[model samples]
Target: MLNIVLFGPPGAGKGTQSQKLIDTYSLIHLSTGDLLRSEIAAGTELGLRAKTLMDQGILVPDEVVIGMIDTKLKENRNAAGFIFDGFPRTVKQAESLDSLLDQNNTAISGMIALEVNEEELTKRLLLRGQTSGRPDDQNEELVRKRVQEYNTKTAPVAGYYANQGKYHAINGIGEIEEIFTEICEIIDSYATQLNA
Candidate 1:
C-alpha cells in the first residue's frame, strides 16, 4: 500500500491537493475532519461526544479520532493506499498511526508537506471564509491562532516522519496544477523505490 500523510497547517491547500492525489493515484482520502463531520451529521454516539466538545471550542480526544481512522482503514482494507489529511497532528498521533498500520502489516509511505507562509494562509482563509462561512476562517485572530497551534503542536509531526526518512516538502505557493504535479512526482518516485 502507498499510504501517505499529507502534512500542512490550516489553509495550506491540503484539501485541494489530497483530492487531486486521490483522483490521480486511486488512493483513499481519509480526511479526519470530514469523517468527524460525517459522524456528527449522522448523529452517532461518537459524533455526539465530539460535537459536545467541539461546541465548547475544545478538541475531541485523540482516541476518538483514532477509532474513526481504524474503522476507515478496516473499511478500505483492499485500497491501493490511503491519503491521510487533517490527522496525525501530534507525535503521539503519528506514533499511534504507525502502530495501527503496523498491525495491518503496512506503514506510512511518506509525509508530503506543503510549505506556505502564514500571511498567505491567512489571506487565503479570509477569502475563503467570505463564502465558507466558517467562523474560524472568518476571524483573522482565530485563523492566526489556528496556524500558531499547528506550528506549535503539529509541526513536530514532520520531524517524526523525517526521522523515518518519509518526509517530503513541496512549495505550496503556485498554481494548483503545478503543485499537484510536484506532489505526484514525489509520491510516484517513492512508490517506484518501494517496489524496487
Candidate 2:
C-alpha cells in the first residue's frame, strides 16, 4: 500500500493538492474532518458521539477518531492506498495511527509536508474567508493563531515521521501544479523505494 499523510497548516493548499494526488495516485482520501462529518451524516454510533462532543464544544477523543478510521480502513480494504489529511495532530495520535496501521499490516509510506510561511498562510486564509464564510478563516488573528497552534501541536508529529525517515517537505509557495509536481516526486520516490 502507498499510504501517505498529507501534512500542512491551514491555507497551505493541502486540500487542493491532496485532491490532485488522489487523482494522480488513485488513493482514497481519508480526511478526519470529512470522516467525522460523514459519520455524523450517516448517524452511526461514533458519529453520534462525535456530534455530541462537537455540540458541547469539546474535541472528540483520539480513540473515537481512530475507531472511525479503523472502520473506514476496513470498508476500503481493497483500496490501492489512502492519503490521510488533517490527522495525527499530536505525537500520541501519530503513534496510535502507526499501531493501528501495523495491526492492519500496512504502514504510512511518508508524510508530505507543505512548508508555507505564516504571512502567506494568513493572507491566503483571509482571502478565503471573504468567500468561505468560516468565522475562523475570516479573522486574521484567528488565522495566525490557528497556524501557530498547528505548528506548536503538529511539529512533533513531523518530528515523529522524521525520526522514522518518513517525512518529506516541499516548498509550498508556487503555482498549484508546481507544488503538486514536487509532492508527486516525493511520493513517487517513496513508491519506487517500496517497490524495489
Candidate 3:
C-alpha cells in the first residue's frame, strides 16, 4: 500500500495534483473538504453538526472530522492506497491520523508538500476566485485570512511527517504536468524503497 499525505498551502495545486495522482496510480483520493461538502449536501447527522459549526465560521470539532475520515478509510480499505488531502490540519489531528492508520496496520508511506511562493498563491487564488465564483477567493481579505490560517494550522503537519522521514517537498509552481511529474517521481521512489 502506498498511503500518502498531500500537504500544501491554499492554492498550492494540491487538488489538481491529487487528481493526477489518483489517475496515474489508481489511488483513492480522500479530501476532507470534499467529504465535508458531501456530508453537508447529504444532510446526514454528521453533516448537520459540521454545517452548524461551519456556518458560524468556527472550526468543526476534531472528533467529528476524524469520525468522518474513519468511516471513509474503512470504505476504501480495499483500495491499493490513499492520498489524504486537506486533512490532518493540526498536530493533534496528525497524531490522531497516525493512530487510526496504525490500527488499520498501514502507515503513511510519504508526505508530499507542494511549495509555492505566497505571491503566486495569492495570484492563483484570485484567478480561481474570478473563474470559479468562489466568495472566499473573490475577497482579498478572506484570501489572506485563509492563507494565514493555513500557515498557522496546516503547515505544522508537514513537520510532523518530516520528523517521520516521509516528507518530500515539491515545487508547486509550473505547468500542471510538470508539477505532477515531480510528485510522481517522489511517489515512485518511495514505492521502489518499499519493494526493496
Candidate 4:
C-alpha cells in the first residue's frame, strides 16, 4: 500500500494539497480530526469516552485515537492507499502507528512535510480567517502559537521519520500546482522504489 503521512503546520496549505493528492492518487484520506468527529457522531463506546474527555477539556488518549484509526483501516481494507493528515503528532504516537501498520502488513511509504515560512503561514491564515470563521485562525497570536506548538511538539516526529528515511520536505511557497508537483515527485519516487 502507498500510505503517506501528509505533514505540515497550520496554514501550510495542507488541506488544499490533501484534496489534490486524494484525487490524483486515489488514496483514502484519513484525517484524525475527521475520524474523531465521525466516531463521536456514531456514538461508539470509544467515541463516548473521547467525547467525555473533550467535554471536560482533556485530551483524548493515544490508544483511543489509534483505535479509531484501526477501525478506519479495517473499513477501507480494499483501498489503494491512505493519506494521513494531522496525526501521529509525537514520537511515541509515530512508533505506535508503525506498530499498527506493521500488524496490517503495510507501512508508511513516507511523510511529506510542507515547509513554509512563519510570515507566509501567518499571512495565509489571517486571510483564511476572514472567511473560515475559525477563532484561532482569525487571531494572529493564536495562529503563531499554533504554529509554534506544532514546531515544538511535532518537530521530533519529523526527526523520527527522518531516522527511518521516510521524511520528505518540500517548498510550500509557490503556486499550488507547483507545490503539488514537488510533492508528487517525492511520492512517485517512493512508489518507484517500493515497486522496484
Ranking by TM-score: 1, 3, 2, 4
Off by over 4 Å in 1: 55-57
Clash count, candidate 2:
0
Which residue runs of candidate 4 sit more than 4 Å off their true CA positions? 37-60
How high a TM-score does candidate 3 get?
Answer: 0.92
TM-score winner between candidates 1 and 2: 1
**Model 2 vs. true fold: TM:** 0.89
Q: Can you give the TM-score per candidate against the true fold?
A: 0.94, 0.89, 0.92, 0.87
Give all candidate RMSDs, comma-separated. 1.4, 2.5, 1.7, 2.7
Q: What TM-score does model 4 achieve against the real structure? A: 0.87
lDDT of each: 0.90, 0.88, 0.86, 0.86
**Which numbered prediction scores highest in TM-score against the true structure?**
1
Candidate 4 steric clashes: 0
Q: What is the lDDT of residue 87 in candidate 4?
A: 83
Model 2 agreement with the true structure over 1-196: per-residue lDDT tens digits: 9999999888888889989999999999998878888888899988898877755434578988898899889999989899999888889999999999999999999999999999999999999999976566787766777788788888789999999999998888999989988898899998998899
Report the lDDT tens digits of candidate 1 across residue range 113-142: 999999999999999999986666788877
Lowest summed-lDDT stretch of 10 residues in model 4? 51-60
